[model samples]
Target: MRGADKLVSDSLATAKRIIDPDTPVLARFDSAFYSANVAKAVRAAGVHYSVTLPQNAAVKKAIAHIPAEAWRGINYPQAIYDDETGRWISDAQVAEIDFTAFSSKAQEEQLAGRLVVRRIPELNTTKLAAAQGQLFDTFRYHAFFTTVEQSVLDTVAADKVHRQHAVVEQVFADLKAGPLAHMPSGRFYANAAWLVIAAISHNLLRAAGSVAGGKLVNARTVSLRQKLVNIPARIAHRARKLILHLPTHWKWATAFDRLWHNTLSPPQLATP
Candidate 1:
């Protein structure tokens, strides 16, 4: 929390410089980054932010104020399949409240934002029974604090965009499974450099897949390596020409040929 303000501010400032000034930028973070300083930094950078808030007395109190009608059923972009239950689970609700935060701070430092909350009912036997036994239905709440104004974006739209952060998580998951399998060196700077190199390699592989222009465009790094990067080839030279022989009857031969021709041949210009 101490240096988070500076980190977020600097990152956002850099983003502002790199992107079109008129393009609206929104930063999204999970509960670990929930802090007044971070929110202030986001506001100062002229960017909107949506950060998950840890449940506390004030948050619970705010949830209590939301009317029953406010909660609207929303579908997950992709249905979550539960192996244990052998079913596709897709039931959740979302709502928002106009809330002011950091009240304890001086008037100048206090911030006003929306408390956007998503609640999933506890459907397990024990929790369901507990809910039936009590007057209230048991629910697990996931709420975020956002500075995005209602006029610019509504609650549903903001939540939808915030959920896009999961794509970043997928990239991290891919990295850990591939290039980041080992820390490489004991030195801090060496490991840091390795991480940077890993990211660059990952992007280069992704670009290669895109250039291949097929299912490989969305293929994982390991799959791309297996198909395109690691195939065995034998080289022979005769009459000042080199011939490379790949494995016969290869399954990915068409895709490999496409990649080869597309990469080796320059794009043809259209005649006017």
Candidate 2:
């Protein structure tokens, strides 16, 4: 754990060195990276951070202390599909309280931040005879710690932004599915070079997808490669001009044409 925290802090320090001081930066991390030291390191690097907090005793206590009236209801127009529960969540209650984390640590080490909590009703179907006719409602709580000021972002907005951290995981999944499936080399440096090339290829494919527009804008790397990069074509010379011929009746013909025109076409000048 200590080694991982040190690596995170070192990486943040390196980022701080290269990034412009004036540029606003925010780091979002999951529960695995949650720690007082990690938060402190983010602060030292001059960046704002939002980290998912584990539901420990202290956090649960703080959550329980929140008043009923403080909870504000929020709705997601497009229901978020939760993988763990296998349920589509459309609504939840959000509230925040000023809380200090890592109180067990020294006063200087403790970090003070807002504990933002979101709760959804726990509709447990199984019932016990002893627990029949429960007087209070049960809810499952999700919480995170953030240093973002209330004026900049309210509880709902903060929660939404924090959830977007999962998008980076999609990129990792794509890489693992494609070029990163195997190391392919015994030497460490050779494998490292391969990794770099894979990253470059991924970025280029993403750019091609964007240029193609329509559905390809957010297409996966593999799909992009199949539809655009690895097309079957023949190069022919006729009348002192080179012509590339693609397969007829291709399903992705329109998308391919859009990509070709956007990439190779000369820019049109504005008429005077």
Candidate 3:
């Protein structure tokens, strides 16, 4: 999905291309992008979605409305107290309670008050033995937030979104393993060409892995080429003018041929 400071209209337009009214719940997990305004864009797609609310005054005010009794034993992410800094960390517990319907039915809005267990991760380490005493530290807080219902805190919806931040991280993993890793340069056209090539490679890799063979497979083409392309062979003269001495049995030869044909073959002309 397109991110950054782009308006919700852009997100909605992009969603319009693929999303239909029949789409089920779209579980969106974003820190800063989910709000009543953004919720409108998703509602336009006529699908149910849940996302992390930003820690702003509006959300905080909504959270304050929930009674402390509802938050009794709930914690966000589970974090142990830090004795040195007296802070909770990287662990928390949480609870959720839906608001009285805000937007329409498909675009429902909810509020939750979560007991966030956070961390004060001030790591003090030294490169040299002498510098151990003069250590620089970093502090971090771990917490969870929710809007599901208080009665069902143990259920999936209450804590599942916080656990799935890693999925978004995986998208960055794909970007780093692709064209976005480096800054393009030289002339504008050259950089554009490079980006075009890298983008094509990335898309082809994804298409080959997920959509090509029915089920998505882990042995994607990117890894396949890295492993197979390095085979060493000798060019020689045989019964004919020239021949290439291939490996004993090329397992990927068939797949490679299919890939080449699909890539180089001309587009099929449509019949009038």
Compared with the true structure, all predictions reach lDDT values of 0.84, 0.87, 0.51
* Candidate 2 weakest lDDT stretch, 10 residues: 123-132
Tell me the lDDT of candidate 3: 0.51
Candidate 2 lDDT by residue in tens digits, 29-113: 9888888788778878778889888999999999999999999999987787766566888999999999887889999988888
After superposition, which runs of candidate 1 have C-alpha atoms over 4 Å from their true positions? Answer: 20-23, 76-91, 102-109, 121-139, 232-249
lDDT of 3 by residue, 132-226 (tens): 45456433333344443446444334455455665556555665665668758868888788877876876667655443233334554446445
Model 3, position 122, has a per-residue lDDT of: 51
Better of 2 and 3 by TM-score: 2
Ten-residue stretch with the least lDDT total in model 3: 111-120
Identify the leading candidate in terms of lDDT.
2
1 or 3: which has the higher TM-score?
A: 1
How large an RMSD does model 2 have?
Answer: 3.9
TM-score of 2: 0.78
**lDDT of prediction 2:** 0.87
